[model samples]
Target: MRRLASFFLALYLASCSGPYMGKDLFGADEFVLDSYKIREGKLSILEMEGYSVAELGDEDLEEYQDRIHEDDVLRIFLYHPKRHDIVQAVSEIGNSIGYQVVGGEISLPDISSVKVEGLTLGEAKKKIEDHYARHIQDMEVFVTYKDRIVRKVELAGLVSVPSVPVDGKIRLFDVLSKARVPTDANLFKSYVARDGALLPVDLNRLLKEGDMSQNIVMRGGDKIYIAEPSAASLMVMGEVARERVISLPSGFMSLRHALAEAGGIPFTGDRSYIQVIRGNICKPKIYTLSWEHVIHLPNDSLLLMPGDIVFVAAKPITEWNRFISQLLPAFGGIEFIGKQCGSWGIFVP
Candidate 1:
C-alpha cells in the first residue's frame, strides 16, 4: 500500500483528445547518448539548481568611499593669478571642511599598497591658499595628478563603459556608476577577469546593497563581463495534449505540474517511456522513468528546475533509435537558460 501510495504521488493520468497513463519525457536524436536508470538514493529532487551564499571577509574595506591607488603622484601647487609668482608647493594643508587631504589606498595582490593623498576641486583649495599657501590676492590653490594612471578596463554586456579618466584611485563602484548599466541587467552573474584569471568580484553586493567591502579598486588591463538573466522557461514538446513552453515559476515546478499545464498527455504519449533531457544542448543528459511504476519516497515529487526541457518519448533512452530523425529539429530549437548551445550540433555522420 505504501509503495502504491508513493507511485500515486509521483503521477496521476489518460488519451490524445481526452485527458491522457499520464504524459511525459524527451530524448536526443543523432546525438550518441549514455543512459542510466533512475537510482533509488539519487533522484530528480537532488538535482535542483538553487542559489548558494558564500562568506566573505572585509579586512581590506576602505573606511572612505574612494581612495588613491598605486603608482599615483599627487601634488599641492598653490597658484595665485593676481601675483605672477611660481606656484608655491606646500608640505601639507590644514584640516578644513570640504574634502580633506584624501590618502587613497591601493589594492594589489602581488605587491604592497602605496598610499597617496588627493583633494577634490572646490573652495577648499581657496581655503588652503587663504590660510597657508600664501595670503590670497586671488584664491589660486590647485591639486592635480602628477602621474596619472591611464589604461582601459574592458567591460562587456549591457553596460556601456565610457572612458573613465583614471586620475587616482578608481574603484569598481566608480566604473559601474558611469557604465550606464540597465536596470534589468543581472549583476549576480557578472564577474571581473584580470591577467587571464577571474577576480573575486561580487557585483550584487557592490551594485545592489551598496556594500563597500566588495568595491575593490579597478586595475589596468582588467576585463569585466556583465550578463542579463535568461528568459526563464521550460519547453514541453511531443505526444501531448497541448505542446507549449511554460514560464518558470518562483518556486519549484514538477513534471506533473508541467504536464498538467500542457493539458496532460494524449493516448499516443508513452507513460512508461517518459524521458527528461536536462543540462545544455551541447552536453545534456536524459533521464528515463516510468510514471506508472512505484518511485521512491522523496523522489515522488520529481520536481523540474528552470530551463529543464520536458519532452515525451515513444520509447525509453536505452531503446532510442538513431533513425528517429524527426526530433532533431525540435531539439535544436531548445534555448538553454543563460547559456549558449555552442558549436556542436546533433547530425548523422
Candidate 2:
C-alpha cells in the first residue's frame, strides 16, 4: 500500500514540476530575439511628386561631345560631285569603312595622320573636312561616332547585372531600368559613389515622382549601389496565434497592421494591455495600448517603428489553467507507467 502511495506521490510531483521545467528550458532568455532598433533619422521615405525631365540644351550637347575618348571608332562619309574616283579610292583603302582613333590620332590614306583624340565630333569633322578640302573640292565630310571604348560604369547591389558597359551619355534611371532593379530594392537609400564622394540618390523620387533632378548623369568609373531594405523589423510575440516578424514597408508601419499580420491575439491574451517594447535589450521602452481604446478612438492607434516588439500579455487565470491542463496529460502517462512497473515487479520506494 505504501509503495503504491509513494508511486502516486512521485507522479504528482513530476506532473507539477513539468511546467516549471519547461519554463526554465524554454524561457524568454533561451531564445535570443533580434533587438537591433531602427535608429531615428536613419531612414525616411522619399516624397513622391510629379516631375519632368529637363530639356537637353546646347551646353548639355557640348558636354556630351567632350566625352570622346581614345580607341573610339568614328565613321567618316565623304561625298563629292566631281570626285567619284577619289571617293572610290578612299573606300578601297578602308578609310571609308571606319577610322579607329589611336593615341588621339587617326591615320588616313594620302592624308597626314590628324590628332582628333581630344576633339569634339564637330571639331573632328572639321579637321577631316579641312584635310579632304585641300585635296578634293566640294567635298562633304560627315563624321558619325561609331563606338565608344573608354566610358563605363559599375552597377552593383539590387540590380540583375553587376557590370554595365556604358557607350554614351546615360542617366541613373536609364541604367537602373536596363539592369532591372529588383522589386524589393530600397531605392530611397540608393547612392552613387563618384571620385571618393558618396552622393545620395533618391530613386523612389525619380521613379514615382518623375523628379528628373534626382536623375544624375552617369559618368565613367562611377559606382552605383542600390541597397536592400533594412533588416530591422517588428515582431509579434506572446499569446498571438502566429508569432511572426513583420517587415515594415517603406519604413512605415502601424501597430494594428502588425498585429493583424501576426494572426491576431488569442482568447487567452489580455487585449487590454498590448505592450510595444522598443529599443535594445539593455534599455527598452515599453508602451502599453488598450485595444478597446484604440478601437473607439482611431487617433489612439500607435505607429510602430522597426525593431519594436509587440507582446500581447496573457491573462493570468487563463495561462495558469492552460499550464495545469497541459500538465494533466503528463500525469496520466506517468500513472500508467507506474502501474506497469508494479505489475512487472519493479521495486518502488
Best by TM-score: 2
Stretches of candidate 2 exceeding 4 Å from the true structure = 1-66, 76-98, 103-119, 123-142, 150-199, 208-213, 218-234, 272-308, 322-349
Number of the top candidate by lDDT?
2
Q: So what's the TM-score on candidate 2?
A: 0.52
Span of 10 residues, lowest total lDDT, candidate 2: 27-36
State the lDDT of candidate 1 residue by residue for 1-349, as single tens digits.
Answer: 5874465334321112211233332332211121111111112212333223333335324333333344455455555555444342242321121122234632211123323333343433444554543334554556554555566677888778644544336777888788887766655456777689666566665776576777766756777776765434677777678889876422235567777888876766667655666776765656655655214313224655556776675433212332234345544554441135344553322
> All candidates' TM-scores?
0.37, 0.52
Model 2 lDDT tens row, 1-349: 7886687556555543111111212222111121112211122222111123123334322225454568888876667888787666655544545788888898876689988987888988788889877876678777767666657678887788876756446777788888898777665456677787665455565765576766767767888887776544678888789999876533445567777888888897878767766655665656656676445533213456656788887776675676667668877997898899999999654
